[model samples]
Target: MGDNIRYKFDYLIDKGFYWSIGLRSSFSHFNKNITASLLLNDTEIDAMGLNKIGVELQDQTNQFYLQTLFRKDFALSIGAEHKRLEITSETLATNNVDEEFVFENTDYFSFYSNLKLDTYDDKYFPKNGVYFNGDLHWYLYASHFNKTFDAFSIAKADIGYAFSITDKLAVNLKSGGGFKLGDKTTQTLDFALGGYGNNLINNFVPFLGYDFISLTGNSYVKAYAGLDYNWLKKHHITLEANWANIDDDIFDTGEWFTLPDYRGYALGYAVDTFVGPIQVKYSYSPEQTKGFWYFTLGFWF
Candidate 1:
């Protein structure tokens, strides 16, 4: 985690109307470091070779919008956003000289819309109903590295359903994906999948067994199936499986199933405490030699 400052203001049009106007702004910093043995075509070394890679990103964003009430069951919002982004990286590119750090700044203006619907019976432990969320972004102007771009778009969605099989058992299913269209998209703007928590501003999704933001691509589709057994009112046991395909050209090819790249399995136990839920999960993936353990005190802050 890094520095972050965010604020929002809302004005209601009328006491009984379900509409509001809002203004929001935020400034944040994010950093990531990676070390991996990557090869191109399974033969030659990748462009950055086999070295530690570091990235530091800073962003300032402001938005003005009108929206339906932020209700538990349904909501809609349309907004215009302006963003300033700066990125600095080391060992991410090679110049064949002493210079190892690279820096760039970009600015973007876009129109976006968001829709959400949720009918889950419970927030922490849902045993019935479904939920859906979708977003669309259309960029009207972008300036990066002294170059300009217009007419870029991004679309993303997530849907989930949960139901009880027996009084003590429940099942949950979820699927989500996204696409980035237009050329010269920045690295940090790509959809990232991995880890156990979400950073919505950066489009970071959680995959059980991988490192934080480890998988990156222009397009991806992922799904999860899980079962929960309530041993008692406050105790639960869970099992889950997830599969995903992440690629730069996923929609253009017929290799979706033939190249199912990432898969994970997990088993977990949870206790509903007075303060919050405590979760302990063990997860495994084919790419790892050992299983991973995750512990969380609450859902998210």
Candidate 2:
């Protein structure tokens, strides 16, 4: 609905589970770049330095997918994504050739097959069950004929388990991992653990020990465990802990944000309930120093 973001959603097939085919498309654009100084505390402290770092990035991505469920617990999905990324410099009041910084446009393409299984007691909110998802994708450099980055394969899997511990308490666990077969990879293709949705690795730690995104790499393995109790109607209290580590490729990158030297095993608390039409989750993390505020999106339960 906004100029910065444009999106359209449509289901080629509207029938329920009995139906076997469907199509979905998504589009988005962004105006994101280093508009401010790294030392944000003083934006104007170094005007020229700030302008030197002023890299305006225009990003647009269009994605579409077709999926069919030919079997009871399996779905075969094929998707294609194209990205047009342009980088430019915003030379502020002073226009000096040396001060301007820009990079060549990048055209990225991805094609993939995603298979999902839903065997949980409940898909959206499960009390006791198991869920597994696996996907493999191919990243193709369509715009470059140099062959430096022709193509590569990446595979990822997620496994989750939940069962009751007592009449009043239950335990839940989830593990995820991934690998890239080809040695060639771009920073954009790197893996990360944090933020909303599936990126929430550990229940006790949010934001990769700082913010909602961090601890990135080409390969990763993470696990989380927690006990939940429901004493009130439609409300649960959870206590949990999580641990995660990335492959050596992370250290090889030598970039802290992309792959920071981090230690997992943080503990936290969460309370889950529905407040009117919104799902409310309150999580508390007492060990992180990167100013990780508790996310209200997900809980251990």
Best by TM-score: 1
Off by over 4 Å in 2: 1-10, 14-19, 27-61, 84-105, 122-125, 144-148, 196-208, 248-291, 297-301
Where does the lowest 10-residue lDDT sum fall in candidate 2? Answer: 198-207
lDDT of residue 99 for candidate 1: 57
Give the number of the best model, judged by lDDT. Answer: 1
Model 1 agreement with the true structure over 191-218: per-residue lDDT tens digits: 7777775344656678888766667777
lDDT of 2 by residue, 186-212 (tens): 433546555334222111123323333
Residue 132, candidate 1: Cα error in Å is 0.6
How far does residue 224 in candidate 2 sit from its true spot (Å)?
A: 1.4
Candidates in order, TM-scores: namely 0.81, 0.65
Model 1 scores a C-alpha lDDT of 0.73
